[model samples]
Target chain A: MQATLIYGAGDVRVENVPDPVLREPTDAIVRVLRACVCGSDLWPYKSRAATEEGERIGHEFLGVVEDAGSQVSGLRRGDVVVAPFVWSDNTCDFCREGLQTSCRHGGLWGANGVDGGQGEAVRVPQADGTLVKLPVEEDSELLPSLLTLSDVYPTGNHCAVTAGVGPGTTVTVIGDGAVGLMAVLSARRLGAERIILMGRHQGRTDLGRDFGATDVVAERGDEGVEHVRQLTGGDGTHAVLECVGTRQAIETAFAVARDGGTVSRVGAPQYDEVPMGFGEFFRNLTLTGGVAPARAYIEELLPAILDGTLEPGRVFDRTVSLEQVPDGYRAMNDRAALKVLIRP
Target chain B: MQATLIYGAGDVRVENVPDPVLREPTDAIVRVLRACVCGSDLWPYKSRAATEEGERIGHEFLGVVEDAGSQVSGLRRGDVVVAPFVWSDNTCDFCREGLQTSCRHGGLWGANGVDGGQGEAVRVPQADGTLVKLPVEEDSELLPSLLTLSDVYPTGNHCAVTAGVGPGTTVTVIGDGAVGLMAVLSARRLGAERIILMGRHQGRTDLGRDFGATDVVAERGDEGVEHVRQLTGGDGTHAVLECVGTRQAIETAFAVARDGGTVSRVGAPQYDEVPMGFGEFFRNLTLTGGVAPARAYIEELLPAILDGTLEPGRVFDRTVSLEQVPDGYRAMNDRAALKVLIRP
Candidate 1:
């Protein structure tokens, strides 16, 4: 089978790999139909030492269950399913609490000898807990949207939900990445009355406007914060969704947050020492949202996707075949594509 | 009138000052009935540069309305009241959102030209918003508890409330000062089933136990974190109330926080940066709570104090007259008193 691997900086490649086999009773074999590159994948693509053998990559996919272990229940062979970015035993205390990312028995994909989603097939451990059966056909038009249930859309919703974005609330989404645009859509779905999207890219911010952003600020640093505050009548937004993990992005998130509002950062933070000391403390702001528990939110969002009220798949501006994953990575990294879908 | 002043670090004194008078339509002159030394006060007492002319120093106090400005309503001269640590216009958006500490027109006591709570008389800005009328007498035995409603007790409640502490939740309170002990009580009131108080002081932890701390871990740093983990089946607690502002205290708070739990820091965090990057982000933990919006909680907590269901005032282990204001500061600074109540 063919899979994606990163040999070093800017070196994403498709290469032959062993077909997956069920290794545990809780495991199942998933032959991926559609997998996609995540913005987070760019972290390693931009830096990290060169490697001789490369490593497995990708953690978002929807697929057909090629095989199921004996202990797997509620799912079977040939059932189309979506797997969250991380594998978890849904019965663990953290999983039960809807914080599956912290599940004691769970682990990240493409790590510790686990199969990555950007491959022809994956051996999914804790299959019953990690995979959500999709009601759509493998080649359904809704495949793109359903694929996002694996990580992206849910992560956007997590940013809004954790920040308590709701009807009549004003929101500020920081970033113009696929996840940021998805957050704009999610906030609108959650009834945010106004959304201020801070981004420099004209194309991506245009997509953000289509998704629900009422205002767009193309500035950076202090200028962006000032623009957001100006658009919000000088009080800033009720919620700030930080989808960019850079220090400046986090700073802008807190800077443009209204007093008593929430700042939810769904992006994988790239820096340490957050500015949550005194200034933010006095404002009564709540800092939350991290590592979206996609498994827990997949069910809650499926109905909307099934009914066609949500079109998060619009985030995918480009699609590629398994052999062109390197091009996909470059396109995304070079800002030529919002997100690249991979048909394996 | 007489008032407490901080001429420099470790130099506190009581001296004659001009009598306070209403300065605005929203102001009122309060004859302080009781004022208490706060853990936050020690910050300025520890390192701030000396001044030739002393600055007013106290923020926690209950008083009688000596006079109300022409535009002030719902308050009259001689009305016994408790002023929140900060003055706020309750009608502001932030105040309406139950975050009065961030009220648009609010300002801290003893800052700028505002009269300090430790003074015999204080000109309270935004009188109607800052003063909560107390039913108890000036010299009532419940005065101690009623005074805590101004700051300490509500600060504790804010820690628990922001962390989402609730039935069956396990809580860890770092620090055993008056506020930490009050947090133990607050967690119990919020129905937390297990409360682990991390502190080394025998007397303070004893008070913490009395305030419903089910367990006490005297170890510091890593040992304390380990002890807390062992006590909670190696998963740590669901809520961590950080009542000490030092970096070490915050480190312990995060160390003993269970994945997906909340860390609420009510202390005046002395550091500029916080460890809220990748490590805490991956755990899906929520970091919240800052300066307490004490005014918003005073009404909610008063009934329990009035009905004898809560006794937060027990934290006041010593008392002093107006002339002994310097001694009060020294006593609290040296850990000779949990809290020092002042009578002028």
Candidate 2:
């Protein structure tokens, strides 16, 4: 089977890999239909040290169940499904609490011998618990939107939900990436009265407007905060979605939130520490959000995509064949594409 | 008039000071009847550099309205009242949202030329908004408990409320100081099913039990976390009240909380930064809390004190006359008393 692998910095390749097989009583073998390069992948692609051997890559995908073990319930072969970014035994207390990312028996894809999602086929553990069955037919045009349910869309929703973005809330989304755009959509869906997108790229900001951003701030740092405050009548927004992991992005999120507002961040934090004293402590602000529990949100978001009410798939502005996965990464890294979808 | 002043580390004195007078159309002068040394005051008391001049001290007090400015309404001379730790106009957007501590025109006691609460009389800005009228008589025995409404009691309530501690939830409070003990009391008042107090002092833990702690973990750091996990059937508590603002206290709050739980901290943070990457970001945990909006909570809690349903003032284990305020500080600093009440 052909799978995507990263040898080191600037080295992504599609190479032959061993085929997946059912390894546990609750396991299912899934044949990959679609996968994509993520913003986080660029972190390693840009700086990971070179090694002679390549490592399996990718953590988001939708596929068809090719085989299912006896213990797997409510899931069977040939069923279209979406795998959350992390696999969890959903029966754990944490999973029951809708925190599958912190499930006691869960593990990330491409780690500890698990097959990466960007592969021809992969073995999924806790099949019934980790995979959400989709009603859509194979090759449905809704695949891209459904695929987003595996990670980014749910992540954006997590940001909005944690920040308490709801009816009449004025929000500031601090990124122009796919997740940030999705947050605008999620916040609007949650009935936010106004949304300000903070991004410099005209193309992405244009898409942000289409996604429900009522205003845009192209400035950075203090200027960006001032711009958001200006857009919010000098009081700053009631909620801020931090989708960029950089220190500046997080700081901007904090600065642009009103005194009693919240800043929910789903970004993979780049800095090791964040100051929570003095200014932050005195503001009565809430700091929430972490890795999104995609499994918990998939069920809630699937219907919107199936009913054509949401078109998150538009984020996948470019598509590539499995063999061109390297080019997909290069394109996204170079800002030539917003997001790249890979059909296996 | 007389006031408590801090000249330097270990140097507290009762000194003559100018009498407070109404300074603004909205101001009022309150003759303080009771004031107490706070846990946070120890931060400077233990290390402040020596200076020839002294600074006014204390922030928790309740008293009789001595005078009112022309514009002051709803408050009359001789009316008993309690001032929140911070004064706000109440009409500001933040105050309207029940975040009076962040009011646009609010100011903290003992800051920005404001008279400290531990004085014979305090000139309270925004008097009509910052002072909550109490029906109790000036000489009523409820004065001590009512005094707590000025700070510690409301601060504890803030911790419980922010952490979402309520019916059937299990909570862990880190610290055994007056505020932490008050948190245990507040958690019980809010109907928490179980409360755990983490502290090394058996004396404080005993008070914690009386205040409503169901369990006490004397261990520190990792052992303390393990102890809490063991008590909660290895799942950890649903809410954590961090009443000590140290790196270890914050870390323990995170470590002992269940996945998707909340850590609400009211302790003035002594550390500048907290690590929020890797472990923190992967868990769906929430960190919320700040300076308690005592004014926002005073009304709701006042009835309980008046009706004898609460006795938070039991935390004031020692009492001193106004001239002995320096001894009051010394007793608390030396751990000879949990807290000291000063009768001015």
Candidate 3:
């Protein structure tokens, strides 16, 4: 089977790899139907994150189960499924408490301890807890939304909810990436009265608008915050969803949120010493964000995707063969595509 | 009238000052019956926070209404009252949402726009909103606890709730000042099963235990966190209330709280950065704290104090005349008194 591997900075390759086989009683072997490049992938690709010489790359996927170990009870062969980026034992105390990403024995896929989903076939650990079986037998058209549910959609949802975005909330979504676009949709679905998408691209910004962004701010930094504040009656947005992990994005989110509002950062923060000041404390702001516990959101989000209430998968602007995975990364990195999906 | 003023760092004097009078339609003059030196007062006295020469200080008090503006309803002249250190209009959306400290028109007593309570008579703005009336006309016996209700007690309660402290929670309280001691009591009142109070002084630590601190870690910095972890089955505490606003205190709170636990800081941070790592994200820890909106907790806390369910004001050790307030600040700053009460 073919899989993507990172050998060093800017070094990505699709090479032949052994077919996945179940090693644990709870493992399930899945033949991926669809997978896509993630913003997080840019961390190692851009050399912002430490990396080994060779590391397996992707984590988001929608696939069909080819085999399941004897202990797997909730899923079986031929089952179409969406696997959250992080695998967890759903029965753990933390998982039951809606913090599946912090499950006692949970592990992140695609980085050490688990196999990457960019491969033709992957082994999923804790299958019963990690995999969400599709209610219908088969629907090829649902792959895009399903793929999004694997990571981005749930991540966006987490950002919105953590920021307390709800009816009558004026939301500001920083970062016009696929996740940020999805956050626009999530915030809208959660009933935000206004959704502001911050971005620089016309194509992606348009898609974000279609997904539910009510406005767009093309500026960056202080100017961007001022733009949002102006849009929100000079009081700043009621909730800010920070999808970009950079310090600048976090600062923008903090600056644009209302005095007592919350800044939910779904962006994987890489910078230390997030610049915050007296203004933040004096106004009482809450900064909550981390890896989205996608598994916790699947149950609610899946129905919406199936019912056509959400169209997050539309973020995929280009599709490529498994052999052309490297090209997809270049196109996304070069700002030519929002998301590039690969069919293995 | 007499008031304590900060002539400069480490220099405080009690001197005769002009008597306070209602200055606005919403203002009320109160004759302080019981006022106390706060942990935050030591900040300026110890030169941690620079003070302007001859600036009036202190904000916690239980007093009798000397006079009321015509617009001040619900409170009458000669009524016994506990004034929240923060003066809010009670009409702002933030105030209505129970975050009165962040009220749109609210101001902190003794800071910037507000007058100080460490005087014979203090003028309270937004009187109807800032003052809570005692059910009985004469309740001098409840003065100590009522005085605490103005700041420390409610502030401690805020820490407990913000940290999500509840039944079966293992809590750690940093700092053994009046507020920290009250936080220990508040944690017990909130049903935290285990509480570790980090303090070195035997007197303060002993008082902390009496106030329901199950364990006392007489260590500082990393050692304090390690001791708390050791006391909590090596997983750190379920919640941490940081009542000391310093880099070390904030870091200690962060280090002591367990994965998925919350660290609530009510120490009025002067200038510091809360250092964080990826571990905070992966472990699902939450950090939330700010100036405690004592007004928000007054209604709930007042009943508790009135019913004898809590006695946070037991922290006060020495009583002095308004003229001896300089000594009160000195004693508390030097750790000679847990709390010092002043009568005007």
Q: DockQ numbers for every candidate?
A: 0.86, 0.80, 0.49
Cα misplacement distance, residue B299 of candidate 1 (Å): 0.8
Q: By DockQ thresholds, what CAPRI class is model 2? A: high
Worst window of 10 by summed lDDT in candidate 1 chain B: B130-139
Residue by residue across A120-153, what tens digits does model 3's lDDT show? 9899999999999986655578788788989999
Error of 3 at A95 (Å): 2.0
Ranking by lDDT: 1, 2, 3
TM-scores of chain A in all candidate models = 0.98, 0.98, 0.96
Candidate whose TM-score is highest: 1
- Model 2, runs deviating above 4 Å: none
Model 2 residue B20 CA deviation (Å) reads 2.1
Q: Which tens-of-lDDT digit does each residue in A190-294 have in candidate 2?
A: 999999999989999999999899999999999888888877788898899999989888888889988878889898999877767767788887889999999
What digit string (tens of lDDT, one per residue) describes model 3 on residues B178-240? 889989999999899999899898898898999999889999987887878877777788788
- Tell me how far the alpha carbon of residue A292 in candidate 1 is from the true structure, in angstroms, after superposition: 1.0
**In model 1, what is the error at residue A313, expressed in angstroms?**
0.6
Scored against the true structure, residue B102 in model 3 reaches a CA lDDT of 78
Candidates ranked by DockQ, best first? Answer: 1, 2, 3
* RMSD after Cα superposition, model 3: 2.1
True contacts kept of 3: 0.32
